[model samples]
Target: MAQFDSKFHDMTEGIRAVASLADAADRLNTIVESYGLETAAFLTVSPVYEEPSKPFYVTTYSPDWVKRYIEKDFFDIDPVLRHGLRAVTLVDWKEIDLSDKAVRTFFGEAREHGVGKHGITFPVRGVDGDRGILSVTSNENAAAWQAFLKSEARDFQYLAGEFHNAIGRIQGRPRHQTVCSDREIECLKWYARGEKVKRTAEILSLSPRTVRFHLDLARAKLGAKSLAHAVAIATERGLFFQKLF
Candidate 1:
């Protein structure tokens, strides 16, 4: 029990030591390998809806497989991704519906590219509506895979949550605000100061249409529901008036 506790503590510390996305990716790969898995992936999605924002993905998948997956737009038909999006707990790849032809084809092709024959996925939902999935895969046979999962599933789930939080810290606050542009920030700032779009545009020497465009972009980037919401989020993130008072 003491040995297990110490090892778990070391694992957590290793994940927390990740200083960048690249480092996080490497650490995740190492963690999976330690469990005798062949590959692992971490994917984060914003605005969890039909057409989510561009997902952030880091994986030990072969470059060829990754390129093919992207070119074929396989995300739409991937059973793993579909299940991960809706599942609240750990998901065994076998639990996904494989009756669909597209799903079968995806798995067949993935296997041909050296992807694992068995895997488990952990789905996470953030307080702010962000979603993420962590998957670890192995080429082992069914019996061995099941036995391994029985022993390591709990640790894998813990590591998945740790990886997500580490990524959040590396990404900084208001995860969506990482994409806010200068113009968007300026528009939000002026709007926060009680300026209308027209007045803000005049102050910035731009057209009202242009000002509204920036503000709309800011709202979208910040995942806010409205202009007031956008300004409020930006203000909370200290994104407004960075140079001025």
Candidate 2:
């Protein structure tokens, strides 16, 4: 039981206000692991506000799929992303049909990557801001998944909402805004390990000067008074993945 709470404590420490999109995705992935999910995503409504729109912000997606989705400009016609923006409840992916040629193609690729047929998407709507969706997915059977959701859905949604709000505030938006990168976080993680500039540089294959630059950027984004403070904030906010130094 102590071990169980320790896992939750790790989660609580790692989900901080990230300054990059990749960092946000990484954090969501961490949460997904706790629930035995293979994948999770947070998709937000685009500013277009037109018919058949898609989420402008979709985290931790395959680069290939994201590139294709953007190249094809699918947001102009994706039914799921459209419905997701307006929904205020958890929607099962299987319930939606994508018989259209384009939709089928896109979803087919996602399934090929093991996204699974069963999924639950939590729709988060904000008043006068960018609405968002936090979805957890697995290959588990639909009925069992639904039962689990019935028990834990509201709490998960509430937490997702709070996380969404925090991300928005950091990005200077009321709704959703994209920020953060993998490298920035990688650098921060080294800092959290108590590595000095030169040492962290050697570990990351970056120059000592480059290490300082990334730390500076991290500090500014986290509103930290110093490097130590930034590390503390990141740990408190769930930004670091490894054991804290």
Candidate 3:
């Protein structure tokens, strides 16, 4: 997995301190801005297996645009929103065939109020029929946007899950307790690779006892009966990223 940087460390810490959904949405915007994206939205609806609920959103979209969207009942014609609700993966704007006149006009009106020309939406499905969307927009040209997506798609997808889980907790839904700390993940990475406690310590420049301590914390948070089981849980959730160079 990737070596944790100070900026990423700061982000994890910030989430831990998030006071409300609006705070978390703002944090989401800040993270995307570093990638040259302009704004973001987090939406909650129902998964296809269940009946849909009135969608709720925490977004950086302009108030006028959001109001217009609701007043016009735009979700009925919103290609992005319609596809995103049932999408299992990241949905690039270009992937949707926007040949319909109504769909084009909807997005065109959105741009007039501040929506970016290009965007991507990540669908996050949670337990108890909970479904969420994390969408970010940018004004970058196709080539540059493609390059950004190639390198960052996985990261944005992970962020969507985090946002969904965090909002769920705030809304009284079941909370995911398996979110590991940076150091906890680092120790787990080595352990997953079959490193013994001592070797893992050397790899992280820490004492063996310290490495074991972090591993134990990770194991407990994951509610795994063993360290290996914890690693398996993390792997299943795609928790690990590329290792440091």
Candidate 4:
């Protein structure tokens, strides 16, 4: 493996240069290869109206495995996914509460599909109520796995955060536009530039509620599930930057 610092620096720059979600996902595969891992997956689920919307996932796992996982609806019983939803910190696959038969069966099936016997997952909470998990798996023995974790867990955590942020920037959006008004566009523009809701409201000389209304409208128009997602879509489509000038 390359020196940790150098590998991390390279991965950071590489992810940033990616122009689309597909490219970002490809870069993640490269990063995982550097770590000698068998697979890596980035999964995000955004909440809408207090319920989790559909999951958006990018993974280097085999198509057959992914197909079976979805066909069987294994997500509901997969300990990794279940724990990742509520975990605030890194979780080793071994540490998950897998007393349930369904959970054990899920892992057994995963291993049968070459999904690796060991892994660690980082659970991420985005600022706009988006949840994500960055998981890397290995088929290594216990001793080797422990040593690798001891030496590189921190670097992997940093990589996970960077990978998640990169996906946030480059993920595609719906092509349809719902005809946003000038106020909605203005609010989205400021929000995309990293302004807080209150700050954006102040800049636009509008009430916070009004700003939120416009932002929500903009999100709906763009067919985005979250505010950050909307901003990403808008930025990617050059809607905001073009309007700013």
Among these predictions, the greatest TM-score belongs to 3
- Which 10-residue window of candidate 4 scores lowest in summed lDDT? 172-181
Tens-digit per-residue lDDT, 73-163, candidate 2: 8777665666677774457777777777877886777778566677777766554446777777777776778786755554465445655
Q: Which window of ten consecutive residues has the lowest lDDT sum in model 1?
A: 173-182
C-alpha lDDT of all candidate models, in order: 0.76, 0.64, 0.76, 0.75
Q: Give the TM-score of candidate 2.
A: 0.58
lDDT of 1: 0.76
TM match of model 1 to true structure: 0.66
User: What lDDT tens digits, residue by residue, belong to model 4 across residues 59-144?
Assistant: 98889899999999877777788788677557899887778888788888888887878989977655455667889899889999
Error of 1 at 52 (Å): 3.7
Listed in order, each prediction's TM-score against the native is 0.66, 0.58, 0.69, 0.66
- How should the candidates be ordered by TM-score, best one leading? 3, 1, 4, 2
Candidate 3 — worst ten consecutive residues by lDDT sum?
Answer: 1-10
lDDT of 4 at 203: 95
